[model samples]
Target: MPLSEFGDAWPGGVPVQAHGMDADPFFAGEGDLGFARQVVESAERGELFLYPGDQHYFADPTLPSYDPDAATLLLSRTPAFLGVVS
Candidate 1:
């Protein structure tokens, strides 16, 4: 559902979103990214990570689009963002 639809029903807590710059059109396009940005901007706490030159499934090891660098960075940042590690 669109973020606007959530209205006051939006979930609480910090949101962490990671997306590739070249995300698949079927999954997400420029409009989706713009909407994501709006979500983060409207939220009290949120994080948006955009990996340039990467595509959808960039963090999936089994996928050909897997990007070791971006995936590694994502893995590391995720735990940190969740306060799971220092």
Candidate 2:
């Protein structure tokens, strides 16, 4: 759905949570953070990003895809984000 289509029924006071990474596919509504930052700046907003190491998952530490550093960073960073959106 178009973000702007929420109309008057939309919860305008609700905060948004954006989950992004350095390496990932761009959804139809997404673009580079540089582009995101430009849009945020134009709209007087802020942007958050996660560009940690090649860690793909956090729980299964033994997995070949697990990344220790990225997991740690995600641990430290995601809370503040949830706080912001909640």
Candidate 3:
């Protein structure tokens, strides 16, 4: 659903998390970063990570586009972002 439809129903102070690859063909990474920036501006809590020259499914080890270094960094950051104790 489009963010415009949320209106005031959107939860306030919710953390937004976004990860994107600069070379992703399925989606524009710059656009993703822009949206993340908007969310961070409004919510004041979020993280946006972009891997340069990576494609879609870069984090999936089974995929040919897998980027081990990027995926490892993503894995480490995800837990901290979510406040997970692991």
Candidate 4:
């Protein structure tokens, strides 16, 4: 896609995390995982890329697909992934 045209634009690399499910049929699709993988593969080497498995937006406590375990792991790892320490 157009992303291929912007290869030089991502000199710093990219970090992204998405709900790993097609819960929102309108917004999410099976292609998401594939796209994420493509992004990671295409990114600069030795940079950071994270995709917490099986985690989705509904992973929050009040949501329907709320997965406490997955949420916990995702939340815990996000900071380090972003290189944020406090």
Comparison by TM-score, 3 against 4, better one: 3
**Runs of candidate 3 exceeding 4 Å displacement:** 8-10
Steric collisions counted per model: 0, 0, 0, 1
Locate the minimum summed-lDDT window of 10 residues in model 1. Answer: 18-27
**Reference-based TM-score of each model:** 0.74, 0.42, 0.75, 0.58
Cα lDDT tens digits for candidate 2, 1-86 = 33344342324344433334556445212454445444333342344555544333433588886666666766676677567653
The lowest-lDDT stretch of 10 consecutive residues in candidate 2 is 1-10
Better of 2 and 3 by lDDT: 3
Per-model RMSD to reference: 2.6, 5.9, 2.7, 4.4
Please provide, for model 4 over 57-83, each residue's C-alpha lDDT reduced to its tens digit, 9 standing for 90 to 100: 645798776767766766776687678
Model 1: how far residue 68 lies from native, Å: 0.6
What are the lDDT figures for the candidates, one per model? 0.69, 0.48, 0.70, 0.53
lDDT tens digits by residue: candidate 3, 11-81: 57677777878677554544655555555555657666778765878889999989899899889998888
lDDT against true structure, model 2: 0.48
Off by over 4 Å in 4: 5-10, 16-29, 45-55
- Tell how far residue 63 is off in model 2, in angstroms: 3.4
Residues 1-86 of candidate 1: C-alpha lDDT, one tens digit per residue:
46777675236675656455555663366467766776777766766777766377788899898889988988888776677856
